[model samples]
Target chain A: MRVPEPPREMYEELEHTADWALRVQGRDLPALFVNAALGMMELAGVRTGDEPGEVRRIELQALDKESLLVDWLHELLVALELEQLAFREIELQITGGKKLVGTFQAVPIISMDKPVKAVTYNELLIQESPDGLEATVVFDV
Target chain B: MTQIRKQDFTRLTPYLWEIPTSFQAGMRVPVRLYADERLLKAALGDKSLQQAINASMLPGLVSHVIVMPDVHQGYGFPIGGVAATRLPSGVVSPGAIGYDINCGVRLLSSEVGLEEAKPFLSDLATALYRNCPSGVGVGGNLRLSAKDLDRVCREGSQWALKNGFANEDDIARTEESGRIPGADPSAVSPRAKQRGRPQLGTLGAGNHFVEVDVVDEIFDEQAAAAMGLTVGQLAVQIHCGSRGFGHQICSDYVREFQPAVKRYKIQLPDRELVCAPLDSPEGKRYMAAMACAANYAFANRQIMAHHVRRSFEETLGGRVADWDLTQVYDIAHNMGKIEEHRVEGELVKVCVHRKGATRAFGPGYEGLPEEYRSLGQPVLVPGSMGTASWVLLGTEGSMEQSFGSTCHGAGRVMSRKRAKKTVRGDRLKAELESRGIHIRARSMPGLAEEAPLAYKDVDAVVEVVARAGIAKKVARLRPVAVIKG
Candidate 1:
């Protein structure tokens, strides 16, 4: 019997002094959003509580897809700081490469190893990839 | 991205290098670097020089883009980079000032001798950790109403004085008298205000710290005496910024400028470098909002200073006869200021954006305090965790060459990911403790990321600036205890 190959990682951390960066990939725009959210939470070492989580929705519009992705991730970060919520599952819808509507099942954050200050647009460009789309995001910390 | 090579630079002097506009297309002026050959090689290992070159393309830039010896790669602008643009037409990029607006260092000297304070070192560290709110997701002791928050936005350290967090001398020693002019709270976003309301007086995570040190050496007795430094005496350094408030403000502006740049027909190599003309409405509003964050940081440090003084008193009041901590200086390294500087033999007003650089005004500047008018401004250079920090003075060379600025701190050479992968926080803490240094931290991974090996040699960085005549060293401080989040 042949062994199945392990799935590829949705995101990988990049090297940056004084900040954090990650290269995120997905099969579609919505997947890209989901992976970015997960990657950010992972980089911050966020751990969640065992209680049943709550579902929250966010709607945002921006000038472009890159901006929309940033806004989405920023919303998640704000929720992590203000509401102590960490996303367990994320579903996103992209409209016209400018609008994003998303719902996430969030659990109470038990602990975080670090904090990301802000999401940046430094050299940020969403490009075509073998999977579907890819982009590099830098977070000030 | 193009790879930078050593052959690409013109060796102007033993400590200075220049990359003329002829090296690249669309560069408005030359990019000057202050580094010895070895430091220059380290800069070539990263993309910081390229970021400086990109910054040179900004409109109405005067002289050249100045890169300090400790320069490192940042998102839009290189850390330890300085740029001045002519007013009326020049642009002010938010990234050039950094996300943590007014992120700075405050040094306080004391009459307490190291011998007298030795027994209370551990207790002092514990007191400081308990008194100062730190780490991620921690709220401060005071909650502000909307009106009181606005007062902090406008009044800066004066708000702390009114609230009994600071004395007049502390304000006098602070940069811009602990408050920048024209801070309009109305211009700040509601989201930023909400974030600022809860985070005041917090030393947020990611390299922000409070360290206690002993004056190990004094390079200049006159200058050191003027700043209240004495060998074998204890001192405290508070390093932090505006916290979530500043981050949200910078994020809001950087996002808003994505559209404003298009409206102004501004062309930038990177989207993060997006900016607006200083005379434009967008630029004016961003400046106003930035001032609010700047003032907020000033007040934050003032309140932290109060707690630090209390911590000292609670631990060593009777043990040491004179345990009072006096203000040496408070200066911001990450900021954008409107000032007058000579360009091409003409005195011109410009906006000097110092991302990871400190304003090092030399002697004879009227803005300095009366005691320091002839002694020049005090420039505090904090090292990475478990290293020697320096006290330096601004020089006339800084006024002439680097727009009244000098290196901020020991710049990072290794990435956080690489550091965390190779170093264990528990082992590092044990090592430091064995060296007689006390450590208090909330996160192991965060502590691992700030290991000393991850940064450049601060002594080497200071030597480059001193040899270049941009700044003069005064004293060296050795860490005895540290508190971090």
Candidate 2:
């Protein structure tokens, strides 16, 4: 199933005492996932090189939308840490809120000011909103 | 969100407060908080108490959930929270133990006087910053193969010792001798191994650092002498953990436990607090994998200690009479240890989960080294950057009250975002440098995020723990040099 790209009111950083939190929204599940990834990358201060990007395909399955979101973000986090990979462009397909098929243009990261250690499931809930869907995530820094 | 009011708590003592099970639904145990009036107000300002109430609902919890004076809001179980569940069928929540498994502090005392080392502080800081890898996506010089990584998973600090990164004395002074048993490398995921491989000696970013301090005050001369801490002398504190390896292991388990909770029919108020029984296959695997990460952290710190020693030697050897730094103690703040604690007058086996809390085993515990056994285990409490750190000793009160645990650090009072907004990293660095403290940091924004104003006062936190009898102050340390990632 496909939906139009969400509005730019994608994600916003929320205040957390000891960690990083992001309040993310999307017109659809795929948009929500993409925006969440972009929010995390921005929060960590990730910057990429000008070199051409490589399109990579990612297929992931989880118990639910929240789990899928965490798994997806964590996949990007690991790539950023281990391989210095960041997404330049993203195309995600969501099915039943349990499986995700994403093809993102991976670019080499030049630098990241801070490291986002792990994506947490703290108070994590993906709910229906008038706009589409909304969820908040906490990242352990 | 459940709102917890200050008036809802029953003041058990001047420094101890309690929220009985009646205060919330599904609570199996009362939540006990160790905080003075002001700190209690601070606790109420956040959702920490509400999280504590949620933690008390975990299955098989024994006694009460202990909240330290430095308690603050975390995801599910509040940071600076401690809870022990009866063994065999007791539940183990990875979130309660935290993501940075075995994230801890190692304190090494030195005989070199602060005055003598003052001139060389800059060089020492530079040496440390260069020797010990810091910053984001940084890898250490020691690149381990898959087989060697397994050895690290199995041997911990012993591996460092074999590789000349640690000494026998260093291992002897460490908690659990720098290696935890029941670590099965097979239990760890390949992704975790991949992350742990090259980051052994690196100090990754976010609230982690290597700081050189001057022992400014000795609260207990007897205990201080035993730990080789003296007024006017220098000390080094290395604060970090298992790095990416531990984070991955924890993330993997926390995700795995999401469904495990459903399988075991354990109900939790928050999904982050998802757990499995100790006897269950899921729980056993998590424990084994967690131990591997714990051991990896032990080796990581040990290797960093070696680099610290080398940096000290290279910078201060020819100038000072002695530049050697001896291990005072190394203690993990985030961990789940299986031990026996006296509960309700009966010695029972339990899994004590300390998330952002330290194990402060009192005197006479068999786990302590012979010399420290009479004085209790030394607890290393590294303060916020630019603030004073503390050296404390465990007491009988900790055994009876907090499951042999105490506060970890001056817990965060302000959000990192707020800190960055309020304090410019360059300006803060300049201020500390003007105060005669040498600073080496990775990024200005990162430094801004860890501004001292972001955390609670360490002295007040120590006072609360000291008054509560969970830990006793031994020495106070003021930073002279800081190396941050």
Alpha-carbon shift of residue A21 in model 2 (angstroms): 0.5
Per-residue lDDT for B1-485 in model 2, tens only?
Answer: 45788888999989999999998789999999999999998888778888999999999999999999899999889999999999999999999999999999999999999899888989999999999999999999997999999999999999999999988999999999999999999999999999999899999998899999999999998999889998999999999999999999999999999989988999888999999999999999999999999999999999899999999999999999999999998999999999999998999999999999999999998878888999999999999888999999999999998889999999999988888889999999999999998999989999999999999999999999999999999999999999999
- Lowest summed-lDDT stretch of 10 residues in model 1 chain B? B1-10
lDDT, candidate 1, B126-154, per-residue tens: 99999999988887998999999999999
Displacement of the residue B252 alpha carbon in candidate 1, Å? 0.5
Instruction: Enumerate residue pairs that collide in model 2.
Output: none
DockQ (model 2, Cα): 0.85
Candidate 2 chain B, poorest ten consecutive residues by summed lDDT: B1-10
Off by over 4 Å in 2: A1-8
lDDT of 1: 0.92
**Predicted model 1 interface RMSD:** 0.7
Q: Tell me the lDDT of model 1 at B257.
A: 94
DockQ list for all candidates:
0.77, 0.85
Worst 10 residues of 1 chain A by lDDT: A1-10
